[model samples]
Target: MGPVAALSALGDRTFGSLRRHRNYRLFFAGSGISFIGTWMQQIAAYWLILELTNSPVAVGALALVQTLPVTLFALVGGSIADRVDLRKMVIACETTMGIQAALLCFLALSGVIAPWQLYVLGLAQGVAVALNAPARHTLVFQIVGRDDLTNAIALSASLGTTARILGPAAGGIVVAAFGPGVAFGLNAVSYAIVIAAILAIRLAPRPQRTAPLPGILGSVGQTFRYAVSTRRVAVTFFTLILVSTFSFNFDVLLPLVARLTLDSGAQTFGLIASVFGAGALTGSLVLATVGRTRMLLVLVGALGFGALQLLLARQDSLPAVCGLLYLIGIFYIIWGSSSLATLQLAAPEHLRGRAASLYFFGFMGGAPLGGLIAGSLTAHGGTRLAFTVAGAMAILIAGVGSIVLLLGRSARARRPRTARESAGV
Candidate 1:
């Protein structure tokens, strides 16, 4: 069959599962709005930082403030999600995000915005996100039953990719038309729409829960132990880290490409980011239609992503980089959505929040470390060298991760050695 015919058939099969569920539709709409605001703030923040410092290192530091909180506090956030009504938790988190954007707008509009001010607000928002991330995923299962869990995950992935395409482009226009502050203010308003959606959702009754009283240190230890104890879970966590460290830093690196390499203005930079978003959008759609829940696809996507990063590193032309970035986005989304679907499905209902916490901890928290490393390395060695290093890191990690997964499978397949143990097994 032709590609279009194949796509049509795939959609016909996959979408039926999604359309049957009303709660999934509501969840999808709310997530889309929230994600759009998220992307808008991200673009505005990066542009503001670049404009203020004109230093790649400073830009990385700004990115750090946005993600470091996740690395530190996500475990506690997961515990909160498990203990609380996750829907209400999302509302509270959204409120915090709205307040953050409002603060950013105030600083920008008042003409009192400093680089340090952005840094502080970014850190504050990051704290809110750390609290929200686990709540967000755990709530997804409530919206769509386990029967459609993989599809819901893919659907959520599509929303992220769609927001990525639209948010940066709109943010650039707003920034160009008025200022960075205007974009931030607009993002704050977008949160109201998400808040309304959350309040409107008719949710299923919650399962029994114990009051989780793990202090920060205890939470961290439990999260770490949980991740270490489960093989599939541990691999999933490590894979997210590998991807974040190598592939996800591309957005943070784009301003460097726009100013130093392409000699493009903010508009061009936004377009470059949008290209990657477009690629991710395509990937998410494909994954949604195909709905692969196996490990094989994840492995392929990881390797494909690493190769795409190397291709991006080799290209200096704006259009070439755009194409490469798109490819990178595509692979990243495919790997991420598939892995998340499997991990979530495998996790026990009781441990879902902790499981998701580990995933976000790897994906979000690892990003700043990657951004810092990429930006600082680029500042000293030049953009090309930085790209080379990033690409190399991705390729290495993908290779290592793939080998580990395969060896793990092989080990699992081996026969029992002890006669008494074998009899019991």
Candidate 2:
């Protein structure tokens, strides 16, 4: 096939889910555009923090604020998702986030944006995110249902990865030429688009919550019990906890890579970050086409992702590192999409929101500790050392997850055999 033919085929494959599901199509289309704007703000926010403080630790603190709320409130949010209309919750959260972005824009444009002010906005953003993410994830299930769960997640994951490509690449230029204010303003407007999309989504009537609502803490405890009891769910969450804490602080690593490692500027950071996204988008599309949530893929992808990050840490040249990042991005998305799909499929319908919120809890909870580790190590030994440690932790967790998977497989194998033996006797 020629280049144009290949491009057309790619588009068809990547968007197959959208073609099949109307509600999901609307949700994905609007969310996709908004995701780009969110990333634009994300990259610019990191850069802005670095500019104000010139400290890696300060940037890490920014990550802390961005994540800590999710870590703290994701369960409550998840609990809320179980009790409410996901569409309305998502709409409210998006509105709140948009207002927060507008405030940031004003702060930047007025030339009075302090590091504390940025941090405060981040805390607000985090709360909305904590509340927003689980409902948003569960809403996809409401749109597409369980049979398409993995495929839907792959496509959904693509929104963020693809945004990584356009958002940061454009953000770099906008921030470099104009300022972070303009990017923030664009992000604010982007949220309005998502809100409109949410309004347009026509979901099947959700199951009535006939049981009295559990206390938020009680609901969270129930989700935890469910997660740990199901073998696949258990393994998936453990792997997320382990790898996410160490290997997933790209926000911390990327800025340091540009400033400290490459001795470069915003454009370089933006470009390389987009390169990473290109690799990630490639992986997301590949997984979506395959349409399987095999545990084998998740385990193997995690192992490879870590090893590649280790390789990435060793590179000094921008060209070489960019190449490594591209490969790492591929592994990263494959692992993430597979894990998320598995969790969604494994959870019972009523508990889906809590399950997803717990997933984010594990996913982002490590940011505080991970950010500190990245900062302290980068401050002393540089990005190389921080990444090396991050990579090693990922590998260690992958190994543990693999053991759990194999043992589960072996146990499953023995069960039917034992039953057959009794029948034979």
Best by lDDT: 2
Task: Report the C-alpha lDDT of model 1 over 107-148, residue by residue, as the tens digit.
Answer: 999999999999989899999999998899888887777877
Clashes of 1: 0
Q: TM-score of each candidate?
A: 0.92, 0.94
Deviation in Å, model 1, residue 281 alpha carbon: 0.9
lDDT of 2 at 388: 93
Candidate 2, 195-264: lDDT as tens digits? 9988987777898766786788889899889779666778888898778988888988898999999999
lDDT (CA) for every model shown? 0.80, 0.88
Collision count of model 2: 0
Q: Which candidate leads in TM-score?
A: 2
How many residue pairs clash in each candidate at the backbone level? 0, 0
Q: In model 1, what are the clashing residue pairs, if there are any?
A: none
